[model samples]
Target: MSESVIGQVATTATSQARADVIDGFLGTTRRYTTSSAEGLKQAWDECDLIISHLALGATTRLIAGLLVNKKTDPGVVVVDEAGRFVVPLVGGHVGGANELARKVAEGLGATAVLTTATDALGLPGLDTLGWDTSGDLAGVTRAVIDQRPVALVREHPWPLPALPSNVTEPGVERVERRGTHVKVLPPPADPQARILLSDSTAVPDDLPTVVLHPKSLVIGMGCNRGTSVAALRELLDATLGVHGLAKSSIGVLTSVDAKADEEGLIELAAELGVDFVTYPAAELAEYQVPNPSAHAEDAVGTSSVSEASVLAHGAGLIVEKTKTPEATIAIGRTEPRGRLAIVGLGPGAADLLTPRARKVLSESAVVIGYRPYVAQIRSILRPGTEIVSTGMGTEDMRTALAIEKAREGRNVAIVCG
Candidate 1:
């Protein structure tokens, strides 16, 4: 469970001590004192997870609802006073509630009951949609080995358990994270319910009892086959540098399906706790550039690296395509704030100022461009506003001037030729 969710649980326990349903709320804070703001923030995040774990009070319930909306990964599960039943009100798997349920049950001398189908029917499961912080790895491993069903946490109000009870499972369901497609298929629940995931999406699939919620960014990738871990690290550094993106911004890294089991790729995914996707060769080849990577060309199932890169971009998994190995290390997408609009005005009419253009001009802190262009919007300018203009300026000149003002934290509106 998330620290926030845990704190809510703790708060609930504290407030509901008289209810006797919750054991006394217990926790330790990193804070030496809550009187300080930083200390308070630590206390706040920690208490969130603790309270979420216990689900002990009203405040816990409230916070659980909020975190669900926010998509905090350490999942939430609320249970009855006896701990016999578990209801994953928020993040079910990624949040650690599925695993936490077992721990909580043991702590309470009860069963950490899991309600997801794979668990009920005894099949391999993985919490594909979870916080993926170090803690989730162990639980996911257990589900894989134990043949227990996994519940992916994506949306807040989890759908009811899917597939009718006592249905048959599709033949041979496997729980492998490093697969080409991590999608879920409702292959008719047999006496053994079979739920397999391939093709992961940002939102959860229409499976009963689970949903997927992913972060917003994608990490584009390419690497040498025997790329040493050191090499991978350097790649990550370079990629992050170019994009100006934080590791936290990336949601997943995708490549040709054959690369799924690549040692370095797997290690990288494990290290980052993010998904590593491998797509079909044909699918990957679709985006192949005029030429392709040496390795990608001969890749099994005939996929192209360029396709993978392009697909990642289109899927919004990656903000942009990466061709060079260094591109993998890009910091992130450019968060550019300034923009220029080139208009060919027949009359340069003041009455025709577009709503959007007018809005930009209106909000500009500094309007720097050609003196004539600046003069055209003179009527719209606020009195005493700074409209720095270089007389007799060309479009390029105006663009450069506008960029200068923008770099200095001034909003510049450039109307070019």
Candidate 2:
């Protein structure tokens, strides 16, 4: 959860109680001030989201002066004095105001006032999918909402919610048969509207075409004990550039356990902002690779370090081992990790629902629950999210189905009342 601030018009007793309720559910830092204008302006500069107990008109007026574009602005949600309605005033999708509004409503037993067309029409927002997206997002999202012909182009078959009939998956055969190795797919021919899902950096840069990068790449490395960080970084940059890979797609940096404390490997992983993983020498030796070094086995007790470590972590090699004077680099594409979250809908009232539970429901790609329970939290779920509901006495069936969906790399949530 990100940091947030709560702004109030005054330090009155009523406002103090309301701020306490907001903080209890939000579970973040909270502040109360008699000065609404100063508090809001300072929150605009310091926080990711703001819950304003002031009047909607007043909050809007104050926000109008501090507004940057949607991408940079913080999410603002206005709670009425009575706490009857939670309204997302600005930055609905980009700043996460709509989702915040839903969570707040659940805590306050209020209604979330959503005005975004995509939410109203039950269509997924392009920017809200949690992927690195580029180009004409607004146009492509509108096409999805209007049921226009939008081509879905993918280099790999990523698990996503069911799209509208108007959105067609182009080159289905190619996408279905795509090999483990990463390759750039050609753009749709004369596409009027397009949404691309791929790990590769190369994609068409035309208007109304949005590119979504999947976190699919893992870099396996091996380095000498005293190797310089500069040398390792240079090799990494050159290798990614030559292969046309996106840095955003790289998810992990891995090596043999012998290099776990190696300064160069640790520093490089920190610079790349990816997790560093190390496998035991015996584990690394178990994996077969194209290049196995007898010298490495004599020195580090493993026949291979760079390529084998990636294979040990259940990834297929996309780029073979490339070496420099002090470091060796190899890249692989790993299957997406499956996630399963078991959530309980607290008591019966919406206000009883926990914030963490609400957040899991919002982020899930698939939600499974009883038919009645599913309906309870349906309003908070993102558009286009898949739902599987069953009758009573179907516990085994629901659990089995949730596991199957998760095994396919889908974020799944099971709800229990």
Candidate 3:
């Protein structure tokens, strides 16, 4: 899913010539070319994006029956007969039609006719943040666009783009009891419309909120030699449920190296779709956990296995060791490390951009560079990427800004021409 499959539909000789030029800019070795209606259907089934050198009306008519949804459908971009104007026909924001159209226009020296409201206004679309998001998308986006107040509730500090001023953290209030004032607590903001950043599976009741979950939790486990996977699963599920933590937030399952060959831990990690890692006993013994055991020291040369392994990886213990007859489990929260990529865009041409540079650009949440250089790679950026473009002679300032953005846990790309 990281790389996109591009299909070129060109029945006429002139269209085929245009397709060849676009293909060179795509930087893909495999070419899927089709010339008939049947071929177009096949392309739709296999391709992630379709470049049709056909009339806008004709392309629409052909793809009308194949449309599934913006989430599932391939982006469709139509290039005119003369290759003068490129237009995004469908899935403009969600399926990457807008970005693909920009790339195609750059290669052909044509204008990209973009009409998406958020793109036109230089605002981040809600659907394009590369997170699992749902609920009140259009409503929240409209609130942002209109400069209306939109409250942001976050369970953890995530590396995100610079949002507009309209989206702000909510205020708190003090509630009073029958006769005395109680503790001060922050009431939920805009129950009818707000954004919630939480990895917990529990959804707020009767609230029109958009939820975005961040991967932050790590699970540390220590099990007996032949613990059953079913027993371990039951204990893990109970731990998460009792603590109101989401299993989706579990990023890694770790233990001491003594359990490296344990079948139960390996199988459970695989079933949960997370990485399984182990730390050596000598390494795990460095961290002083609250609940250290002499029995564990005699068994594995480490005073603590479940808690020490988590702290060894720079995570804070959110949950202490909870154990069953044969297994022990602990949960910790880890901060995400930020990344900074200084990419060189050779020759300022679409075809000249290297695959590695293009990948960094697309994965970055923020792109900082000179105005011209930023514009050159703008088409390759995913939706919701914040661009910080300055004039020439500001290289030092741009580099500093990029570093600061990365420090905030964002993937930042500083593009140079």
Candidate number achieving the greatest TM-score relative to the actual structure: 2
What tens-digit string does per-residue lDDT give for candidate 2 at 1-417? Answer: 124444433345776687788778777455647578888888788777788888889999877989979888988888888989989999889888888898889888899999999777766677777667766777888878876778887666565654655666665422211112234445434546989887777767664787887778889999888899899999988999999988877778999999999999899888877789999999899888998888789879998899998898788999999998788899999876668999999885655788788777766877888888888887777665767777778788789978987886667999988
| Between candidates 1 and 3, the TM-score winner | 3
TM-score of 3: 0.64
lDDT by residue for model 1 (67-168), tens: 534235345545564456555544455455555555455445555567765455433233433322222344444443454454433212111112212222
How does each model score on TM-score?
Answer: 0.31, 0.74, 0.64
What lDDT is reached at residue 238 by model 3? 99
> lDDT of all the models against the reference?
0.46, 0.79, 0.79
lDDT for model 1 comes to 0.46
Pick the winner on TM-score between candidates 1 and 2: 2
Alpha-carbon deviation at 210 in model 3, angstroms = 1.2
Model 1, C-alpha of 6: deviation from truth (Å): 7.8
Candidate 1 weakest ten by summed lDDT: 155-164
Candidate 3, residues 261-320, lDDT tens digits: the string is: 999999999988788899999999999898998988999999899999889877899999
